[model samples]
Target: MNTGAVLLYHAAQLYCNLYKVTDFQAKETAGIGVYSALSLINHSCYPSVKHYFIGRSLVMRAVRPISAGEELTISYIKPFQKAKKQERKILLQRYWFSCTCEACVNDWPTFPNLPALRFKCLGCKNPLDGRPRVCYACVTKRRDPDKPQTEQMEVVDSIWRGILNACCTDLALNIGQKKTREDYLTVCQNLQLLYEHVAMPCQHVIIMHQLLYKYFEDEF
Candidate 1:
């Protein structure tokens, strides 16, 4: 019997279906395992669901509101909310599939040191590149009404950029440590103040949402 070959094949199957079992409370890798149901869910960089370990039982919970019939998804990798599309693709290569998640396809800006943030057009509320005074759609609204308009309602990109820059600088002081519960609460509240102004699919918002979920799930 070719025992070595059998073990290799078994390892490959596990690689494709494995889930990193994270200690929700400790926020670290406890181990890995295979789950039949979870392996069926697709991968999205900006996943709709986040999973964690609870004493060998894997629990999947939605990070955002999903519409009826929307396909369920969970990220195959971690800390990718800030990564570029190409970088993310490289990280996900082990899964043997190219990621086309909303964040990846649109190249969503990451925080702490975000690039020039983009906001919506004041006239038509469509996303305008580089803060243009008026977007092409709004300018040619009457002439070409069929132009696509973004549903994301972003404004004050510069303000958020500055806020994150300050945040990252402060956070660097406490690197490799979780923020105090009070710190998370304060951050969440401050984010709420400008929550409405932020565009859909924002990386900072997504990352914070995941953190809050993890915190409350384990601590509370």
Candidate 2:
């Protein structure tokens, strides 16, 4: 081969070595193979689509609704969480590109759907000023002839713990194998619904929201 042809051959080999066969399902590394079409898909932290191995062929699906004319993007690494600006720059170094996705652009805020950290009162569902024994809306109710202050607070606390534990348990179980996009998204969305139902923001709920945003922000 001519020198130019020889150089081209080595470059192709190196590219395959770096980007080919992302993972092994069974126990054989020899099974690694690359596809030209699959290689063309670019990397994004907030990908609109996802791909998985189906036997020897690859299948791609939209993880979220996509507008016409929008680019189809997928992640080359685990991407369900936000990272610091510097951290993102470091992570993108492997792919050799600068990211300007919404997360990167905004320095990774909680996904657009979830906007605040304020918690609601268990009694009246109003936002709390700070941690308190009683909310403004509930103060009068607690003082009524039939309602006792201590009893109401205890009931609210019990209900809150139960919801939080259920959410945490469901999320942990779904993080394992056989988990699907629906599985993870359901837990995340349910947490949001629970917050709305209770009319309160919680530390654990906020953390779950953040985690969900990190991984599945593009989904919804």
TM per candidate comes to 0.59, 0.45
* Candidate 1 segments exceeding 4 Å error: 1-11, 113-197
Write down the RMSD of all candidates, one decimal each.
7.5, 10.5
At residue 162, give the lDDT of candidate 2: 51
> Runs in model 2 with CA error above 4 Å?
1-31, 80-82, 109-220
Worst 10 residues of 2 by lDDT: 211-220
lDDT of 1 by residue, 29-141 (tens): 87888899998899987788878778788888665657799999998875445676777878889988888877777776555544333444545655556434346776733
- lDDT of every predicted structure (CA atoms): 0.63, 0.55
Local error of candidate 2 at residue 6 (angstroms): 6.8
Q: Which candidate is the best by lDDT?
A: 1
TM-score of 2: 0.45
- Report the C-alpha lDDT of model 2 over 1-220, residue by residue, as the tens digit: 8999999987775553343332324324435666667677777766776665545656676654467999888766545354455766786776667877655675544333444445555567776555555677767333453343344455445545655654564566567624346656555455545555433223444455444433432232
